[model samples]
Target: MQYAQLGRTGATVSRLVLGTMNFGPHTSEEDSFAIMDRALEQGVTFVDTANVYGGKDHRGRTEEIVGRWLARTGKRDEIVLATKVFGEMGPGKNDRGLSALNIRRAVDASLRRLQTDHIDLYQMHHVDRSAPWEEIWQAMDLLVAQGKISYVGSSNFAGWHIAQANETASRRGSLRLVSEQSLYNLLSRSIELEVLPAAEHYGLGVIPWSPLSGGKLGGRREDGVRRRAADRRHDPADLTEQLERWETFCEERDLTPGQAALAWLLHRPGVLGPIIGPRTMEQLDSAIEAVDIVLSEEDLAALDEIFPGPGGPAPEAYAW
Candidate 1:
């Protein structure tokens, strides 16, 4: 577990961040605890979750499970905790977006649920178009001033949106987002065309989610099950062409699709870190092994030929 700076904020985080999307729904509390323990034991000091991952219909279940683990292990200080907001959490419209009111409300709820007073890296789950950039950045800045969160970031945002927010923060002289999280993988290299360059140019760290392209790279699809629908890969509509190209590339590289996929991103320059969402120790090990499976120039060329960048039609809005 190598460590890297969290953008320009001077905070260091583990190279591999443990994502807890399964903590609430498909995974049980005991399983969640075991996963967290194993990740920590393996030196993964960065954990990412969200207020919406808890139980079905009951938001914040994942945080509750993490809170219990923290209390039991007394390891809150040992990890760099990251979580997100902006998904629909309830019936009311107020439950969503980056509005100052909701940011305040959500942070308090997140703190209570996670059993922590301050978050390490707070993030906007997605770019909420309804709110102006200043309003959102100002609200996050307030949280920083109040000592509720150490740093701030964004997820599923376009390069332009992040630039706008950072410019807004500059004008206000507040803390701007230091990191940007988006989807990146062998099958989904679209970010390389814009988002990645923007992050590098602005000195913003890049932490991509689903580096495995859901389960497609993992090599364990059940019979009759869709390769992506079950695991939420790039929008099904946009994946056909990319997945086909990936399948061909895997054969030529003599790499399990997963290894090739992860290895490609592991070596991409300017990536602060890539979030690995493994459900078990085996899956986790495979992900870690990818860090060392260096790809040759030829291998990369093959991939570039398949998932060519912004020149092609854009992937769907829901691909994230």
Candidate 2:
């Protein structure tokens, strides 16, 4: 459990963040508690969750499960608990988005469900295009002043959105986004086109979510093909060919595809860490292996050749 600064902030966090998205829907509460216990035992102090996580019908169940774990273990101060906003957690018009009202209402609800007085990191689950930055920052500022949250972050945001957010926060003399949670994996490198660059420029730690591409790179080659097929983004035949090449490379290096994939993210520049939402204790233990698995120059180059990202950052990615 190597530790590093969370972006430019003075605070430190573990390289392997424990994500609790699967706590309620896929995993039983007992298993969830056990998994978290194991992670904490192994020094995974950074735990992430969201208020809207528990499957469609049970939006707050995941947080409730986490709250119970915190209460039962009495480790609230030991863990850096993070969660998200900007999701529909209710049926009202003011239930979602980054409006001041929603952000205020959302944080209180999250605190209750998480059973924590303050969120270590509160993130915007998605970009709320309609919400003005002034309004959003105002709400966030209030929380900070009230001691409801320590830091703010963003997830699933475009490169431009990252720029927009920080620029606004800067104007308000606020400590802008300290970290970014984006979809980045061997199968999806779209963020490399701009998001990574923006985060680096703004000094936000890059935390890659779904680092396995929803199990595509988790030694389960078929998941990649099946998921891609549903979106019709790539021909199934081409995707299979790619996955076979990837598997062969992993085998030659005596690595599970999961290990190699995680190691790749660990090696990426500006990446603080990748989020690991393990459904079982074994999965959590397996992910921990990559934290120590060093990928050399050759290994990284080979991975890039196998899963070439969006060319590079734009406008170079698109032009000269």
Candidate 3:
């Protein structure tokens, strides 16, 4: 497991983050435990989860699973644990959003479920449009002062949101957001339009989730069958052609499409690796192996031709 500083922070984290989204809903508790054990054993030290990952009825199930694993393994000190807030965790209106009240309640609930005193990184699951930056930062600043969380991050935020956030944090003398978890992959390049650039400019590490675009790039089976199309809604001719070209390129290079997908993110600038949410040990190993599959400049260019981004970034990507 290669290590890099999480954004500009001195605290180092594994390049390949072990996302635990599948722990409660998709994977059984026993399997989840085994996979986590294997992850730490292999040096995948950064783990990410959320308060609403356990499906509708079991909102905090994933955290409880992770907490139990921590207690059993006694490896709390060895791992960098991150989780999020700002979701409809209950029927009450206050049960959601980034209000200071909710933030306070949410962190304590997450800490209890996680069975840990302090979270390595606490992220906003989504931007709360209603919550003022001062209110949000005030709550977060209090948490930091109390040693409830070490750092703050964001997910599913746009470029300007990142700018507005850190600019506010800077004024308040806060460490601000150190990372941004966005949906990024070979197939999903929209983030390049603005999100990626903002994170880079703000000195926030980009941790890409859904790095395989929900298994669209999970690689074809040995029998040459696609588990699912990249996008079923509008499978345009161009997208079909791109998929064909991508498959052929991977075949010629003796690489699984999944590996190509992950390796592509690893090659990207400002990327702090990607979130690999493996449901099984084999899946975990495959993702770990992808970390070593280095893509050359030519290979990257070919991939760009297949899944071309928003051209480049901002005005240049559009106007010029």
- Candidate closest to the true structure, highest TM-score: 3
Give the poorly placed runs of model 1, Cα more than 4 Å off: 220-228, 231-254, 311-320
Candidate 2 lDDT, tens digit per residue, 1-320? 79999999998999999999999999999999999999999999999999899999999999999999999999999988899999998999999999999999999999999888999999999999899999999999999999999999999999999999999999999999999999888888989989999999999999999887776666654454333324333445567778888888988989988888888998888999999999999899999988888888998888889888878898898898
How many clashes show up in model 1? 2
Q: What is the alpha-carbon lDDT for the whole of candidate 2?
A: 0.90
Per residue, candidate 3 scores C-alpha lDDT tens digits across 193-272 of 89988999989999999888777777667797765744553354446667788889998999988888888999899899
For model 3, the superposed segments whose C-alpha errors exceed 4 Å read 229-238
| lDDT score, candidate 2, position 211 | 84
Worst 10 residues of 3 by lDDT: 229-238
lDDT of 2 at 58: 92
> Which prediction has more favorable TM-score, 2 or 3?
3
Q: In angstroms, how far off is 38's CA in candidate 1?
A: 1.2
The whole-model C-alpha lDDT of candidate 3 against the native structure comes to 0.92
